[model samples]
Target: MTEKVLIIDDDTNLLSGIQRQFRNKFDISVAEGGEKALDMVRSEGPFAVVICDMRMPGMHGVEVLGSLKEHAPDTVRMMLTGNADQLTAIEAINEGNIFRFFTKPCPSDVLAKGIEAGLEQYRLVTAEKELLRKTLAGSVMVLTDVLSMIDTDIFGKSTRLRDWARLLAGHLKLPQPWILDLSVMLSRIGWVAIPAEVREKFKSGESLSKKENEMIQRIPETGKKWISHIPRLEPVAEIVFYQNKGFDGSGFPDDEIAGKDIPLESRVLKVLNDLAGISQDTAPTKLDFRQLDLQAQLYDPEIVQIVRQSLPKADAENRDLYFETAEVPLNLLIAGYELLSDIETKDGKLILAKHQQLTKTLLTKLRNIGEIQGIKEPIRVRKHIVRKV
Candidate 1:
């Protein structure tokens, strides 16, 4: 909600005068030159609007704003110059994505109006992206929730993979972490095509017949195809497709893609998925660590260590900072709350397990199940509210 604006000009007098004139109306900060403006962007940024003088020493307005386009993409950029040349204006618009161009000695009121318009445009565009993400996320969750109902084990593991991926992601720099999130959320969706009995046997560590094995082998490809059709999800599909591929280049959908060639998110997911599956009942500690060590060559060693670090911290964080248990009715359940106890039928048959986060998709599944099978009332859950620093 910050309406912060930054004005950059080599002329200190002009910069100070502009600040004084509009300081009461806007949250304005003045930078003496391009370098100072960029520094402020890195240190104190996400400004809603930035205005730069076109003729600054060493760096021109186009260069400054072009760099800003990459560094703070959502910030609206404007250009001001005494020249008012057509070439400068064209280059500014094409290179810097400039929102407004002003010649020197522009009326203060006109400049203020332009600044206001730029701020509103920034707000509108960012809001639309946010809305699209949430709406898309909700729609995707519907698919995951359906998978959960059909195969609880796979869906639960996918959720665990998502949490573990998040922890590992903190140690790495990913341009699009949400791609990993979407990748993990729908990681096991490919398994939905396999027969329930086959999936159950796999979970029980039983060997599958040749035909059964073939179906299981094709899961990653099946998942990739289904996801790729969605717009803006191509990267997500790639992550999912490679989720089972070994970091050492040794797993299914066999190809030459190996060692760092595989998507990093997939490698992290691969480790976490196997780590969780090795012995689900045991504490996520040394027990899982020793098991992963046995299959060490199958994963990225650095990512393996990241998972190792995540174990104790995640357990402690959940118990101390996140979990607050409450027994609430099904209708009161909210997305993001983790179940602390098993959701089961009135006859005590297990439905959803403890520690599974309630998502909107799962909420719908819970409602449908409540109506159809009649679940136990006052469900036990841990409302996951992170304690702020």
Candidate 2:
């Protein structure tokens, strides 16, 4: 756990000076130009602080800092330049998100303190992010494991779907944790509502009758019922309900949600589910599920392309963790909500519905901030069908 400091400057004298100044206090790596510096930062990091020169031949310090921010954002950036021009400093601060600006005549003590503080901040921020990632990963494992018992087939599908969902999320450049892990895990809960015969038929490429299609439509409702009761899953439940939705407003149950109005998670999941269908089915390779999904009105064209590009990469990392750990729990249906206590045991119906709505809102806000991927539409829960009393 040694703290690493990266010094990038065209001036070998200044680079050596800084390296020697901090030699006793920190571990240092030096580079003469921006390109070489960038390569170092990208490959051998977790760098604690990056000290860069503003004036250089190949790439200026500000430009180098910008690239560093993109490649290793958590690394603290400092600009060291001879020029004290206020406008240049302001621009660097705004564009490159520079942490500290040091002039050429900076005192050794002051520069040392700046580097130390920057490294401290980097350590804190990276530690927080690593903790968050671990937390999210742990929660995902628990939830996916539980889901495996809920439905073995769905567990396998969910694991595969999550692998693909992660790829789609990255392809779309989404940052939401729950959307990537939870949405894909819960996407197949709707299948729990479909009869084994219908699911087998759907998987086997058998076309269903109109009545069968309508029955299949109720799967979302079934998903909602189960999802609403799980407090931890409330946020991504809409994806479970609407992964089959159309981007052009042609998906099942509620069709009014279209384009950006649809949750991003839903849009991402739509592509994931469609691709999973293509992979699991006997469709010929290069059948272009994205084209078929968009043309058939199951997914948006934009979303389809995003999925298409990421599919190759996702396939490379598809571990099928969810599917392998998932199992058909004994008395799965009868043991609903045993793991969750925040949900109502007294007012089961009303509270569950309310919980469903709250989770949808939370997820919607998270998506708007560009934190998650999937649907671009908000899925409205359909009212229960009323038969003649």
Candidate 3:
């Protein structure tokens, strides 16, 4: 694919000259001012490099490039200006994070070389991001799959928590919502450390001894330890670490951090976890809103309000949404379908729970397990239903 470059300048003549200079070599886009440049960056971006004139009509090049750094950090940035004062250069380098600084009288050859270097930098940055994303994603999948194999109840809880987390994150308009989603999915991973008999007993709502209760209480800490070793999962680890913390400085691991001091993601997770637990016991009704309201000290009050407002909408959406149920052979089962009923092992142990959304990795593992241990046929799934407008 041809690499894209964007040039922004107040001078239309200069813009035209630069476009003509590099149009043949690179796919070039031009913006007259900083505002338009930012608009283009948002809409038609992922440009390999962006060249901005330091002095512009509305927004300074430094401001524009600084904003770009926040919006698209991987896009290489450069600043060009006639005024090459020391302060201008300093601000451009410090604030804008410009990859290259050039004067207006800069030779075409020099500018061309800078563009080439900037594109190279962009390539390196994006390549590293892609690698990290894939590696972290794969590791998470492996961990969750292990959880599914060891204890499907925990896996099912994670899946449900993931769905609720996504909805909450979306409602709040949080950036990169996937981080919250991933945090929720892996939040229960520490349960693996508990003995299988203990886990089963806990699942059955059996009263636990003091030692067993302590072991259960330590699951979040154990999960944090597991997540901390993985590269690029520090945020996830932090979220998981504080999942049990309360808004009023109450709850396990006994950290004094409370209220806004807790990460927003953690606060959101705590409320959702409580709500999910409540729903599992009994279907939440409007009357239950009072119970949640009474528990305000336990959650971020603002987030609690958002959840209250969101629940009715969620209910309406769920009611309107319809899924076509179908029974498919184990080998033919595809990912992204919701399980309508529990999938159990030949010995009647639950392998996957109802309402869990299947994933590619989960499906592949299930297939492998089936081939080894003979799974029953006609696995029930809720087929993806596309609503008519």
Instruction: Write the residue-wise lDDT of candidate 3 on 244-333 in tens digits.
Output: 898999997697898899989899888877776666321245655566777789899998888877654324346447656789888888
> TM-score per candidate, in order?
0.82, 0.52, 0.78
Best model number under lDDT: 1
Ranking by lDDT: 1, 3, 2
lDDT of each: 0.83, 0.65, 0.82
Give stretches of model 3 more than 4 Å off: 1-48, 55-71, 85-91, 106-117, 166-175, 280-291, 301-322, 328-332, 345-347, 359-379, 386-389
Leading candidate by TM-score:
1
Q: Rank the candidates by TM-score, best first.
A: 1, 3, 2
Tens digits of lDDT, candidate 1, 191-236: 9788889988987889999999999988988989989998988888
Question: How far out, in Å, is residue 339 in model 2?
Answer: 23
Superior candidate under TM-score, 1 versus 2: 1
Compared with the true structure, the alpha-carbon lDDT of candidate 1 equals 0.83
Clashes of 1: 0
